[model samples]
Target chain A: DAGVTQSPTHLIKTRGQQVTLRCSPKSGHDTVSWYQQALGQGPQFIFQYYEEEERQRGNFPDRFSGHQFPNYSSELNVNALLLGDSALYLCASSRGQGSEKLFFGSGTQLSVL
Target chain B: GIQVEQSPPDLILQEGANSTLRCNFSDSVNNLQWFHQNPWGQLINLFYIPSGTKQNGRLSATTVATERYSLLYISSSQTTDSGVYFCAVEEYSSASKIIFGSGTRLSIRP
Candidate 1:
């Protein structure tokens, strides 16, 4: 079922540049969530998308924004990236917003130089 | 906001050995899950135990929801089990934010 698919397995961007990472949820799944994992740390929730709208947000700033499509696919866009933003970006999908049994995709490793 | 904490920040064991990992949360949660992050940066779901116990082959997990803690037991550990184990929780509320603990790094020797 491809579990969850994330695009651009690796990305390199310069400070102040913009980057977008994409994700396709598992089959029949309707909810998508985004997370950022720094080295040696567990993933931190960035936001969640359900019904093509953001339902919950984390401590991340507006520079980290996202969109979910009708097909339950999602895109994470970072504007004016900073070196500290370099990390592994992960995408997870589940059946419903309340469900916690998530399937994650191989994250996109973003390197902000 | 909920706080999740995992014990034994790091573990080293020999193949065929058994070990246990613990996770504690600061607040009540509706769901709890365990994940293993491989070297390739992929999170593989291990268990979705909000309460009670579940066994999957040589792996078993028990969650004491009333105590706000969960435990993962790995028997006959293999080299492939060498990775980071994380415990995540979904706090009870209309807006669910799954928070992950710092994780316990496991290393198995051949």
Candidate 2:
């Protein structure tokens, strides 16, 4: 059984540009969540998707949006990126929702140039 | 929103040494998890301990939900264990959200 997988291991974008990162959840998992991990800090919750709809969200702004496909894969799109947006974008998957164990991917390293 | 705090932001130890990391939350939590971020920035789940105590080889975790704190113990540390240890919690209010602590950076020297 493969664990969570993320595409575009690393990326570089300029301010005001948009970027989309993708994730494939672990086998047998249905819930996907996104997190932002700034340098020297812990991972902060971005949002979560379940059954093709957003179930919960964090304190992030509207520029940060996500989608969940029927297969349980997810995409995190950041529009008008800022220098402050440069961080490791991590995607985690769980069996359902609520308080459950999570399996995380390696993460996409986004650098705003 | 609940507050999560971790102690000993940074630690260095020789191989075979032992260490303990603590996490304190502001309110009672229904879920508590520990993760280790490897050098490559991969967040690996270490424990899913909401309450009670669990031991896995050289690693063990104990969560005192009543006290709103959790402890992660590492025995006979190895260089492979060098990474940032983070404590994440989920309160009953939010179903999908998890609040994470700053984490403890651990460096094990061989």
Candidate 3:
């Protein structure tokens, strides 16, 4: 079975520009969450989407937004990117809205120049 | 908000040795998981032990929800075991949000 898949394994964007990373969740999973991992750091929760609606969010700014399609696929958009935005953007999928095991994707490496 | 802390920010062990990693949370949680991030930058799920104990191969994890802590034990470590081990948890207040600790960097030498 295929695990979570993320598009644009690597991306580069200049300051003040915007970028969108996509994710296809694992089979039979409905919930999707996004995380950001800086160099030499652990992944930090960004937000979660369930049933096409955002369920919960972390301490990220408003510039960081996400969308969940009916197929359970997800997209993470970061606007006005800054050098600090350079990091690995990870996507994880779970079976339900409850606390369950999550399957993670290899992640998209974002390089904000 | 729940807070997670991992002990021994870094560790170096000889091959065939064993080690234990600890994770402590400040609040109760409904979800707890252990992940091993190899040098190649892949987060591999190790265990999803919210409570009780589970063992897989040479790795075993036990989560004591009542005590708000979890421990991961690695036996007969190999050079391939070198990586960052992270403990993630979700508080009862928000099940969708999973918070991660700083992680324990483990390096096994031959």
Candidate 3 lDDT over B3-108, as tens digits, reads 8999889999999999999999999888899999998788999999999999999999999999999999999999999999999999888877999999999999
| Candidate 3 residue A66 C-alpha distance from true site, Å | 0.9
Which segments of candidate 1 are over 4 A away from where they belong?
Answer: none
Query: How do the residues A1-113 of candidate 3 rate in per-residue lDDT, one tens digit apiece?
Result: 89999999999899999999999999999999999999988899999999999999999999999999999999999999999999999999998899999889999999988
Which of the predicted structures, 1 or 3, would earn the higher DockQ when compared with the native?
3
DockQ of each: 0.80, 0.91, 0.85
Residue B19 CA error for candidate 2 (Å)? Answer: 0.7
lDDT of 2: 0.95
lDDT of 1 by residue, B1-110 (tens): 78899999999999999999999999989999999999888999999999999999999999999999999999999999999999999878635699999999999999
Which parts of model 3 are misplaced by more than 4 Å?
none
Query: Candidate 3 lDDT (Cα, whole model)?
Result: 0.95
User: What residue pairs are clashing in model 1?
Assistant: none
lDDT of 2 by residue, A17-110 (tens): 9999999999999999999999999999999999999999999999999999999999999999999999999999998877789999999999
Q: Give the alpha-carbon lDDT of every model.
A: 0.95, 0.95, 0.95
Model 3 TM-score on a 0 to 1 scale: 0.98
RMSD of 1: 0.8
